[model samples]
Target: MYDFEYVKPGSLDAAKSAIAGAEDGKLMAGGMTLIPTLKQRLASPSDVVDLGGLGDLAGIRKDGNSIVIGAMTRHAEVAASADVKAAIPALADLAEGIGDPQVRNRGTIGGSIANNDPAADYPAALVALGATVRTTKRELAAEDFFTGMFETALEDDEIITEVVFPTAEKAAYAKFPNPASRYAIVGVFVAKGGDGVKVAVTGAGPAVFRVAEMETALSGNFSADALQGISVSADDLNSDIHAGADYRAHLVGVMAQRAVKAAG
Candidate 1:
């Protein structure tokens, strides 16, 4: 890894200030992906602002109809939360299935969402659950939060403080994960709320996106049969060695059906 200064900020303001001060500073959360990039010499930030020391940015709270998760809360915590499991079991299941034991232990929710890997599980949960992403600046609806691959609406120094996922009537997440990496080849989150039905797909596209076609059909008939003729075209999907775009597209349909079935 390239030489860089490390700053362990004590508070939110301190972390923001440290990040804003450096010319090419970057916030370090869990270091699951950032450290690997640094070691590969892909990114060389002048300063690394470590958010781990900020004790305030970690917890799970019930806020009215939503469950609010602090930015720095680790995956394992979310997976193990009694409140989360009881109220939103599908979310807890998503967290429980992320990566492996080590990644679950070290990876933070904020870090995962910020990185926004196309195959990551959190984005699917956020989108379908109609969650709100809270940053140092403002709250962004989950649909508006994800801009594109590895990109978000966040400004340079704005850190994600928390995420608010509304309690849906029913919801579940299904994934066809890569055996080796455990990253979703195609993952879908299905939810039925007062607003109606919503379906979000990740791992198949450049970013997590709502499958409007599927959503409409499912809203009328919440069943595997609802997704019969619905198809995900391969024209704008991610194609890696593990799976091709067409295959991923096909998997999206399959996963969505599974999510609906599992949710019921």
Candidate 2:
């Protein structure tokens, strides 16, 4: 890792200040992706501000009809939280399926969404659930929050505080994971909520995107069979050594069907 000053602030305000004051600052939440990148010399920020000490930034709670998950809340916490399981079991299931034990225990929701890895799981959940991302500066809709590959709409020094997800009538996520990394090669999160049906897809393109045709189909009939002919085009999907764009496109349809069935 490149030599850099490390700051673990005790309060949220201090953490913001620490990052704002540095010429090149990076926030560390659980350090799952950041740590590895630093060690590999892919990133060389002048300061690394660890957000682990901010205790208030971790937990799960229900607010009216929505589930609020603190940004610093670990994946394992979400997976094991009674509120999450009872309110959004699919989210809990998705969290439980993230990586292995070590990654689950250490990776934070904020970091995962912020990193916006093309293959990350949380983005699909956020988009499909119509979640709101609450940040230190302001609140953003999930669709607006994730802009592109490995990118977000967050400003420099703006910190995510929590994510608020409106409880869905039914929701589920299904993925074709890379066997070793467990990252989704093609993951789909399907939801039928107050607003109607939503089908968000991840790990198939440059970033998480919705399948309008599938959503429309499921809206008319909330069943796996409803998605019989709906499929996303393979033209823009990622095609790595693990899987081709056509295969990923095929998985999108398969996974979306699986997600709908799981939601039921």
Candidate 3:
């Protein structure tokens, strides 16, 4: 790994200030992705600002109709939270299925969404559940926050503080994960809420996206059978050794069906 200064701030304000002052600064939450990138010499920031010391940035609590999770909250905490399981069992299930024991224990939801890996799982739940990402500077909808593969709407100086997820009337997630890494090859999240039905897919394209046709159908009839004739086009999907574009597209439909059935 390339040489760089490390700063572990004790508070949110201090963390932001430390990053803002650096020429090229990168924030480390769980360091799941960042550490590997740094070790490979892919990223050489002037400073690595660790957010772990900020005690307030980790926890899960219910906020009226929503579940508010702090940015530094780890995957294991989300998976094991009584509040999360009671309010949104599907979300807890999704967290439990993230990586292995180690990854689940060490990876943070904020870090996962911030990195915005195409195959990452949190984006799907966020989009389908209509979650809000609260940063140091501003708040953005999950759909608006994830701009593209490994990209987000966050400013260089901004740090995510928390995520607010509205509890859905019905929600479930299903994915065809890569056996080795446990990353979704084609993951789908289905939900029915005040906003209506939402079907979000991840790992099939350059970024997480919703299926409008499936959503419309599921809105009318919340069942796996409602998705009988719907299809996902492979035209703009990712094709790698693990799975081809057409196969991934096919998995979208299959996984969506599974998600819908699970939601029921």
Tell me the tens digit of each residue's lDDT in model 2 across 150-173.
999999899999999999999999
Model 1 ranges with Cα > 4 A deviation: none
Q: What TM-score do all the candidates reach, one by one? A: 0.99, 0.99, 0.99
Q: How close is candidate 2 to the true structure, as a TM-score?
A: 0.99
Indicate the worst ten consecutive residues by lDDT in candidate 3: 214-223
What 10-residue stretch in candidate 2 is worst by lDDT? 227-236
| Residue-level error in angstroms, candidate 1, position 180 | 0.7
* Tens digits of lDDT, candidate 1, 55-157: 7889999999889999999999999999899878999999999999899998999999999999999999999989999999999998898999999888999
lDDT against the true structure, per candidate, is: 0.93, 0.96, 0.96
Deviation of model 3 at 223, angstroms: 0.8
Q: How large an RMSD does model 2 have?
A: 0.6
The global Cα lDDT (0 to 1) of model 1 is: 0.93
Ranking by lDDT: 2, 3, 1
